[model samples]
Every structure is written in C-alpha cells, then in structure tokens.
Target: MSSHSTGTGKHHPVPKRYALLFACCLLLAIALLADFLWASSSNLSSSSHSSLNLSLDSSNEVVAVSVSTPPQPRSIKKKKEPKAVNRELMYLNATYADIPAPHWDWEEMPEAPVPRLDGFAIQLQNLFYVFAGYGSIDHVHSHVDIFNFTSNTWVGRFDMPKEMANSHLGMATDGRYIYAISGQYGPQCRKPTNRNFVLDTKTKQWSELPSLPVPRYAPATQLWRGRLHVMGGSKEDRHEPGLEHWSLAVKNGKALEAEWRVEVPISRGGPHRACIVANDKLLVIGGQEGDFMAKPGSPIFKCSRRHEVVYTDVYMLDDGNQWKQLPPMPKPNSHIESAWVIVNNSIIIVGGTTEKHPITKKMILVGEVFRFNLDNLEWSVIGRMPFRMKTTLVGFWDGWLYFTSGQRDRGPSDPSPKRVVGSTWRTKLHL
Candidate 1:
C-alpha cells in the first residue's frame, strides 16, 4: 500500500505551470464580477439625481405661476369714489337737505322777437309780455311783444300808446291789466313823462289814467292793499335820486282816485331797483345813487360818464308809513329791476351790474345767481350763469326758470359789457 501511494503522489506533481495558469484565471474572473457590480451601482445613483432635478424644476414653474396672478382685481377697486362728494356740495345749506337736490342743465329756447335791455316782463296766465326798453345805440323801443307759453313761441306783437314812456318805465300787473307808470319818455336821458296808463290784456286796449304830479324814472310800482304804489326813482333830471312815494286807488283797471296821494318817503332814493311785495311787506333791493346823464349841449344826446354809487341797501315797508332796513345784498348790484323771481318762498336775483373792477375801474357784469331766502332773510349764491350779463328779464313757470334779453359780456374772462342778446335760456328747478 506504501509503494502504491508514493507512485500516485509522484505522478500528479508533474506540471507546475498548469497550476499557475488555473490560479490566474480564477483571479481574473473575480475582478470582472466586482467591476460589473460597481458599474450597476453608479448608474442607479445617477438616475436618482436626474429624477430629483426634474421634480424641483416642475415645482419652481408652479411657484412662478402662483406669484404673477393678483394685480388686475386691485386696479378695479380704486376707480369709484368722486361722484358721491359732488352731490353733497350741490346743496350748500344743511337746512335745505329736505328739499330735493336741484338737477338742472341750461337749454336754449327760441329767441325773443326783439333784442332789448332794461325792459319789463310780466307773466299773466300762459302769456309773457315784454314792454318798452332801450334798443340799439340811443334808440328806444315802444314795441310790445307777447310770448305764448303753450306754443313756445312769440305769438303776437303790438305798438304801445304814443303817450307811453319808452325806457326806464315802472310797470305792474294785476293778472289782467298792466299799468304803465311814469318814465323817461324818449331816448338818451330825456326828461321823464308824467303820463300813466293801463292796458287790458284781454281787450288789448289801453286807457289813460290820471297823470303823476311828479314824473320819475324807473320807479318801484306795485299793487299793494288795493292801491297802486310808487316809490324810489330818479327825478326828471335823470341824475337825482327821488325818495317821493305816492299811491293811487284803483279797481278793475279803472282808477278810483282821480289823483295819487302822497305817502311816506323811501329810506333810500335810487333807480333800477327791484320792488317786490312778499308776505305783505314791500321790499326794495339794490340800486345806484347816480345815473348816466346826457352831455349839456350834445345834439345826439351823448351819455356823459359820471361816478355812480352802486349800493346793496335793502329796505322793507311793513306798514303804510314806516320803513325798516333789512339785510343788504351780498354785493353791490344794480339794473336788476326785472331780473328777479320768487320761488319756494325765496327771491332769486339773476344777472345785473355789480361794483366796478377794483383795478380797472370798469363796469363789471354779474354772472352769479343769487338767492334771498324770505323765510331766513339770508343770502347765498346758488349757481353761475353761462355768461355775465345785466338787465336780464327773469320768470318762473312750471318749475322752469326762464331768463332772456340781457346785455352779455365780451367773453368769459372779460366782464365788460359787449352786446345785447335776445337768446332765451331755461332750466328746470327742483326747488
């Protein structure tokens, strides 16, 4: 058995080179397996990093879209706040809050048939009548024009009595009869006439009345307490202010008294004043102390420029012989004899001549619409006219305020008197 074991061991130990080759082949196989495993791990890590980067990019895009979407709604909220403040300013007085806010816009109406200034307008029923006034240059018109409210047109015109005074006339109406009192008979500062007459509007016939002992220019005439009362005007010289007050009894377009009876004199004497009887109290407001006069020997009757005292003094007559001073106007105003109307228990005075320019010393026209509250006795400026003017004829009918036939200014900036216009304007009043 010993001899067989030694021979088998000796036969197997024949080739050392084959053994070395087998060992090298095993090492190579192990190295190749380890490299394959390492490659697989690296690839997996790279794939995970790429997926994480794509997810982060998607999140960033979502965040950008959310941050850019809100400014449109914020801009729409800032545009709705100014209209509420304007409505409150329209009614200046808190006491007038109960009254509806006046919403009005001026509209043009049919022009008057004749353009005149310093004329008197009377409204009776549906008809509006315009009497004599100063025309172009030095011409005075005695023409009477009638406007029909129903037709919205000037329906008829007629000639005044030859004896009737032309310019600076004192006029009053008792619904059916219009009484024309003393005034400057002819144009260009002539002596005033003592003639007095009454016209029956229905008959269109004029009847002569007892003449005034003293002729006056632009007197304050009104029917009060069954009598035609006249007060405060310029004298026949057309420069002196008269304080004489007279009255005459009348009934049904006929004079009950043959002559006017003298009464209490006015506190102030002036021409181109507004005379109104409200609540049985006669009031005289706004006038000038002096007037334009003709040059002494000019054949054409050239008006001489003179210093005038424009005043805002207001007087009230409660009894037949007593006078009391009331609140003066907000500003000095004149030439407003027919530029006023009574509405809602308030007297509204429109365009007139105001104080001269402080610097230029030129005559200034008023553009503001003034209100005198009869109940409160306070004055406030309500509105502004489209153009400054003087001697405008004002009327109120069916909640509409009408003004026509005034001397307008040259332009908005220029307050100087330029031209006379017959253009009628109307605005609906809420109060």
Candidate 2:
C-alpha cells in the first residue's frame, strides 16, 4: 500500500483537544500485566479537592453521576440547569480518581539500558512483557523488556519478532499470550496497518494472526463471548480521521481470515481510540474522530480521505456495530493521548491536553477525569490529572490506581521540554 501524508505537516504547536485516552484495561488483566501494586509518592502533595465518599451498590451496575460543577470557572459559563447525571448506565461517568503517582518511572526506564515509548504490555502470573515502542519517530525499536513484579525488577531483555513495528496501537492479552494489533508503521505509513501477531508468554514466540478490516491507530480489542472484537481507530483517505466499526471473531484459538466485513452499521467514531468491551458492548471514550461523514456501508479506511477537526465524545456499541450517542463531555477534544482504564464495568478517562480555544494560540493541560456508565448513557467528571499526558501511565489494582512518569504538560515538540518533578502517586477510589 502506498503511504499518504496527512496535511501540510504544518507544525501545529497546540493540540486541538485535551482530555485524552488513559488505560483502557480490564480489572482482571490490569493486575496481571502492569505491576501497579506499589503505591509510590516520594513527590506527592495533597490533592486540591478533598475526597468525597459516595456509597455505591454492590450489584456492579454503574451509579449515574457527573462532575456537575467545575470549581466555578469564574470565566467558563456554568452549564444550564445541570441535570444530575444518571447512574444506572454502564458508561455514564467515565471518570473516577484512585491512581498513585510514579512519575519517576519515566525517568527510570531511560536511565537503564532500554529506551521505549508507546509500547504494548501484557501479563501472565505476575509477569508483564512490554514490547515495541521506539525511542523516537526518527528511530526504530528492536528490543523487548520483561518485568517481574515477584522479583521487583527487570527480569530480562528479548528481541521482538522482526515484523513488530509501531507503538500507539492496540494489544490484547488472554493471560496466556498477547495479540499486537492495528497501528502505524513507524514514520513510514500515515494510516495504521492491520498486521497482527500473537506473543506466547512462556516461549516468547510471535505467531501471525488474521488481519483486521481497517488499518489505523488506537483501536481496542477484547474477548467477548469467545470472539475477538477489534473496534475504534482513526483512518484517512486523504484528509481527517475516520469513525467506523468492525469485528473479528476468533474461536477455539483460530482467527477467521478474509473476514473484514462491516456487518452492523454505526456512526464513525474517531479513527483512533482507547476502547474497552463489557457485556457484549464496545465503549469508546476519549480519542480523536474527524470528518463527520455518514458512511453507513462504506469500508473504514475507504472513508478516510475527508478531513476535519477531532473530538471527545463517549459513545457505545452493542454487538460491536450500532453506535449510540450519550452525554457530551464538559470539554472539547480530539484526543491524542493514551489515558484509559476499565474497572468492573466502568471506563475511566484520564489526562491529556486540548487547545485553549478555536484560535489555537495556547494549549491547556487536561487534568480532569471522566468515567462512562454504559447502561444509562451518562458521564461523570471525576477530578483533575495529577500530571501530564506524555509522562503519565496509569494502571488499576485492588480498587486503587497508580501512575508513573513526568509532569508532562503538552507543548511543541522541543529538543528539551521542561521535564518536571518526576515521581509516583497513588489514590484510593471510592467505588
């Protein structure tokens, strides 16, 4: 396939949207892959807002909620007759707070012999294997890091399958192996490729899998009723991103090939996103979706040519196709960050940056948090991010959340961005 260029490559110093994707993780797997057990806060300061306790029901159904008020932004207009966000929904409030800070991790990764970013991670039996993010767009990644929590350090270094390329994509783990799916090919291709392969944890072997319907970044995958649902991502023909839905069914360890079919119809989501699956539905939180075109039956990448602005809308799709509109976000964003985490049945959206306004002169960091309630289609604003997008990586464990990295605020790609008090922090979530 011939590669395409997105725009004039005009260096837009300011990002259009802020509140981006966080860890779109499942509760069972989060504890397995990321060793977020250690609560570190050597540089921790008290959060500005006092923790408020709201009793939650044990049935696992989401309680309708919304941030309701944003500290009276003496400037931003207050929402009119703010309706109390509903709770019975599944993706209502996609925001909640419970992450411990560990910005120091960003510092630790490089000081060692390895340098990687936008990598993919999977876990099995307290062991996590992260592979494939490169040091930068100008370079290529050729190594993998295996971290053992039981030992509290890097266990070993291994070579990834030569076919492995690109970070900023999707990976899913079955607790036995990891499937590295759709993402770009370094700086070579403008759109992501559907090339996918499986990583065997024991032998550390990579095996190829069937390709996806579309080639794009940030699409999420999940094991639902014995099938692999690959949904969400950004696609471009010549302009903007794409919003489309497709599914991959794998049964008894076999992926159905030549199966790039868009069966169920839907409104295009951002061509890229940090999606998670629950109860036969795919929940798409923050990320970017552009070119609001209506392509009821057209293929995803085929609809890529048209370009437009990005967005931050939380949508839902049951059966992996039909998309339903839900509550709008308090802010406007066409997210470019990775800030997604899944708890029980809820989706947590963490930090990223958004343009200060339409003029795009200044960039403001998004420290806010949002969660989605799938059942009632509501949104809840949790709180502010303790740090920046590039330097933050959040993982949830034992009802608590943890984060690592620098106080990475959004800024133009500079030779040396003002890296801040690198440290770790953790928070206790009131479920």
Best by lDDT: 1
Error of 1 at 345 (Å): 1.1
Q: Write down the TM-score for model 1.
A: 0.75
Per-residue lDDT of model 1, residues 1-431, tens digit only: 56566644566564889999999999999999999999778766655543212222544552322222222343476556667544333322221111222334788889998888878888897788988887875788998998876667889998899989987888888889999999887777777888998999999999999998888989988888889989889987788899999999988899999989999999989899998888988899999887888789988777787777888899998888798999988778899998988899999998788766544556778877888999989987777677778888888888888888979988865777889888888787654
Q: Lowest-scoring 10 consecutive residues by lDDT in candidate 1?
A: 92-101
lDDT by residue for model 2 over 273-374, one digit each (tens)? 555666666665555544333344544322222334445576666644467866765554433334556665666666554433222223334555666665
My TM-score estimates for the predictions, one after another, are: 0.75, 0.59
- The Cα local distance difference test for each model comes to 0.82, 0.52
lDDT of 2: 0.52
